[model samples]
Target: MPLRRLLAPLGAGLLLLSAACGGGGEDGDRPEPRRPESSDPAEGAAELMADMSLEEKVGQLLVPVVQGTTAEENADLIEDHHPGGFIYFPDNLSDVEQITGLSNGLQDLATGSGAGVPLFLGVDQEQGMVSRLPVGTRFPDAMAVGATRDPEAAASLAGTTAEELTALGLNLDYAPVADVNVNPDNPVIGIRSFGSDPALVGEMMTAEARAFEEGGVVPVAKHFPGHGDTDVDSHTGLPTIDKPREEWERVDLPPFEQAVDADIDAIMTAHVFMPELDDSGEPSTLSENVITGILRGELGYDGVVSTDALNMEGVRQTHDDGEIAVRAVLAGADQLLMPPDVEAAHSAVTAAVEEGRISEERLEESVLRVLELKLERGLYDAEPADAAAASDVLGGEEHAAAARDVADASVTLLRNEGGVLPLEEGSAVRVIGSGSEEIGAALRDKGYALADSASAADTVVVGTDGARGDAEQKGLVADARASGTPVVVVAQGNPYDIAELPDLDGYLATYSSVDVSREAAARVLAGEVDPSGRLPVDIPGTDLEFGDGLSY
Candidate 1:
């Protein structure tokens, strides 16, 4: 097959502008990897595909988001659009029983639909601010896990997360964020990435991917090509990475490469624009040059290639929901995730196939990948997840213990000036900041005396997670330190928040405000657990460097 470029105007010149954006020929001619001799998922997928109608096949290309807290509430969308999969958000969740029932009911609907296929239920359970379901044991985010600097621990954490997700009837988890946080001011990727070092991020992502596989759930290593260097959040607007190709490969591509090599189930494309790959200013989620030319042609990722949620303003700003779904399919994305208008997107794809715009062969390729993922999770032969057993597996003693271990391993004691840490028992400590009430309560649970004011305290402990700007917190820290009382700055958000504060008597970063992370930080400050977390990303322009952590 000759290299060919289509100038057919796919979502604002996504097809026309890039010469390298060639939609590859059929898979029959391509050098695909061999499937295992045993009746592998690919074989099962092939058999299933043979029996699917054109509408059923086109439906497999879409994975839409549905509103509602229960399966019955969401069943109409599934029954009407016939989406191959569903993505859940916190708004759609209530509790373990509700979500578990929702997943089971969705699968039942999908399985009994036009093609009788099981739905691939997925959620962004990245374990920190992005966690959707509230039933699982919450661990610290990716950066905190990276601070542990132990790939084995990272793997264990992901494995435990996978178990809880599977028990809830979810077969897919979008996690172990592969973006390397190279920019300190990066609006979205901070603390979500493993670190600034590409190699370390790569290693940690691989470990997490392997662990997810071990736990019988498909893991999606996401925001591919990368979202780390940009300061704009894609949820609001498109972010552009203006660096050269070499710099992108150096900083953003390694973890995704490693993930592909590790046979990750999926690599989700970011909504950011990489002009180095495609100058059309289209988000990578709709750019064939980035998805096919780079991810497929260069990296050789044969697994499912999913788009980041199509509803995000990054991609949505330029294209309507229907157009976004069509262009993403043309760009070689195997899954269209969370289109804003599911009905419009589904109808558009069905029409594109019927009008000879998107080739049936092309539709088949993506459907095969989608079905293979479902078959890999054993959805065909398996029964709906045991919702009754969700209580036994989620947040159980073992899961809690594992969370505590990871949390304890990830506490970074950034500054301990004048040996002020390990405060004596019953020391009068004043706690303040966002979530300060919870942090203070955790301290009280550990037998620390709470002080009413900075002037009356032996020490003032300020807990913040950058949820609000740090200037106010910084002023409070400065005033507390000026009063001649010792001040302990507990960074409950990004550790880099320390750079904005005055030098203090003690500094600690928990990298998250999750219950487990907060408890671990409390124990560390109370002289119980050791502070062992190392820095993943450096505090820009500060003396701090990656791998910097102090212990008691």
Candidate 2:
């Protein structure tokens, strides 16, 4: 389990892959890949690809989801169709032991199937709200991490999260959302993003990318071309970013630039439409001008490029799953994630190659890159995820303590007028609003008194989820303020909730609803830790800027 540990560019490795295939591209004839002679004594990483059939090569492009939890439920996918990997969801997991066993079973099925290069076994374990694993160290959102203004925290979050993922038989993570959350109203990318500042997002993303890969997991920085400025959620519908090219260059493109410069191994595309970037009106995920021209040509990202979930309504608008797969490859994407019908999509790509619509060189290009990633991350020589040690390694005390430390540092005290924070020890407190029970329990665990009535309490603590919008939260805060006791609001969802309730005597922005965030907010309330975090994003209705926050 040394992991081979190559945390840098695959420059020479890629050159060898191409050279082994005898060099193929638009510039010259890409004849069939040749095998080394008996006397040649030289073989390349792509030799497995060269030996693969068209169906096998097409299947390698797909990273689909398994039907149910067990390996037998979708044994056909691994034992027959031979998809390059799988994306695990909550339904596919129960606990560390079950997941480890499932991962081993799946790998066993795939070992003798197709070209036998091993599955990627990925999850959306971004550590915060976008997590899929049943058990792991729970950390705050990217915005919360951004609030800490510490790249090392981001690195620690990723490195530790990666260890747990590998222990549970997962290798790839779709994380470190590189998108700068410029739009406060964005339905999808709010807490998932770093913040409004592209520079900050870039700094955090580079740190995370380096750490996750170095930790033996292939990290994928996601929602490329930036999903930040859109008000619509691409999962429900296609959102358009109508920014001019200049604004895109200033706000959305810098983090991706930093990622490429940092030698990131993979980037997942946004399904968002950029009218200025590609006037033809295709979303960035399917636009050749955006993918091949901008991401590949402009930013010079040489690593693997994957489309965001194809089953989502955003990309499914123009084409069916089959055509979308064809178009994504034509647009220069190397991986297709979450296709509704993997078999149809795989068949479509195979037909595209057979009909000469997609050159053999083009298909091999992605296959080799896919294989190279497997080799680079030590997946090529990997065994089934170790079931015995998985339970102990995952969600251990050290990782939880690390998660709380990050949450503690990310507690941004946006407003503390009249010094209404750091509630007195053992003072009766009334906690209400979203996640009230959990927040109250966390406080009680820290030895704070919980009052049943506001009149009996020294302070009234209210928790709120402002990410869904803040209208009702205003009323809840107004009611709490009416109590004779002092009012303290914990903005657990979005920090901008503070702006909605200007009357709050005390406000702490946890920026997430994760367990550690709540515990950290409890610690902050109990005066165990200092509120050291600053705002990572600007408040929409308030004058507070990105770096504004107060301490005890």
Candidate 3:
């Protein structure tokens, strides 16, 4: 059958829904919506909600991950289940053109729902290791921005990310991680957070959140109630936080509170358990006291509440997928993100309402909240994104330059003993580490000579990151130092790499290994740009505190 013919019945259902009570009228057809055509989002949502069925309303509470690559592969799910939103993973994307088509197709399918509301297409474009989009400007991570101590740079990064997201038809970005990384040994959220200082994290995150809002994307301040102090990774097991309320208020809660005050439209809950907030030992994603009592009650956040992916072991290990969905909604989350089994989740939510375990009114409350955000985002009136504009909008020269500037401003001179940096242009330098190849290429492109081996070099430039604590790399640096050759260490991950090798002649920390960051480190080594960034976190057991850096 033809595509339009296949879609006609679905479109007809939305067209015939009654304006007052979700059924056919006296003449066997529904009338148009009767509310005043004003700009009030609540009034608009209420008018639409009056016409939706119980099954349709429940669907609006879910933001499931898509399982298919094309519209035809997933059209049945969208048409039957009516999920409020969808989040993309790397698996669902191919290129800019494919992503644009997929987004437009999903929105087209959404228009066929009884409410005709647009879907909230979200992606984890956090830019460091968590970036999801296949074609766009890739910026440095959160710590890199924190190292710069310039909120405007953070805002610029978010704004550029938003532009690329919008061009590909995404309406929301799960980004601007507000967690204050108090524990340097934190497994999952190491470089994802802005910094350890609550005030500084708040300042930087608020700037990015506000920028995302202004740039036409919904900003999500994530891992609410704070995921920074914990050491366990939520993806594999639950991390427990035992801090008292006062301690939480001091270190963890400030950044999220700052984000909320900045008018962030959504906040993603963490899967980590905070025993002080709720004694039940459930992760925050399923804790009503944490979600309803703390974030909504104490924080006064009236925006949409999104849960982290339900498939993670932190939540999945404790409950069935269906139960996890039901519990998350009852706990006050407006969106059930990335449920492991979408059908099972839908069935369980439906059964809960049918069995009186969940009231119809309670379901409606979350559906209303979801619709309000959609209306506020202008999803009701947005046109299909232009697929042809993807190239023009993404990875442009302006964004590249912005990323380079941010990288340049974020390279800190952690320990420049004897002023050994600003290496001579023709000096034989040996580069090594996780980003050694990239760093070497960038430096050679800038007129620096890379020696074939450390022994043949006048100076050795070693690159290190949080991923590897390679003793072999340390041995090479030590050998260079022992030979009376200058050893310049570039930290491309956690700045603590310097503390691990304390005997270096010079040290620089870039806080990230993104292309721009590596290039910035190269330029600094070749005397192209002076080191200007400060340390965002402390190098534990050393006197190198936060905000410590040196310039040429």
lDDT of 2 by residue, 349-434 (tens): 99999999999998888888887777678764454555557778874799888898899999998887788788887778999987
Better candidate by lDDT, 1 or 3: 3
Tens-digit lDDT string for candidate 1 (211-312) = 988888888898988999998999999998899999988888889989878888888999998888999889999999989888999889899998998888
Minimum summed lDDT over a 10-residue window in model 3 is located at: 19-28
Per-residue lDDT for 1-552 in model 3, tens only?
A: 335436656564454332112122132232222232657999878877877767778889878887666655566677678889899999999887778777776776566554566789999999877898778888889999999999999999999998888888899999889999988789889788888999999999999988888888998899998899888999999999998988999899989888767668999999988888898989999999999999888888888889998889988767899999999989989889988888899999999999998888878888888888888877766656666677788858998898888999999997777778888778788888768999899878877788988778888888877633677877766776787778888888878776668678888888888888998999998888999999999888788999899999
Quantify all predictions' global Cα lDDT against the true fold: 0.80, 0.81, 0.83
- Scanning candidate 2 in windows of ten residues, the lowest lDDT window is 1-10
When 2 and 3 are scored with TM-score, the better candidate is 3
Taking every candidate in turn, the Cα RMSD to the unseen true structure, in Å, is 9.8, 8.8, 5.7
Model 2 misplacement above 4 A: 1-43, 467-470
> Model 3: how far is 474 from its true place, Å?
3.8
Candidate 1 ranges with C-alpha deviation above 4 Å: 1-38
Candidate 2, residue 465: Cα displacement in angstroms equals 0.9
**What's the TM-score of each model vs. the native?**
0.91, 0.91, 0.93
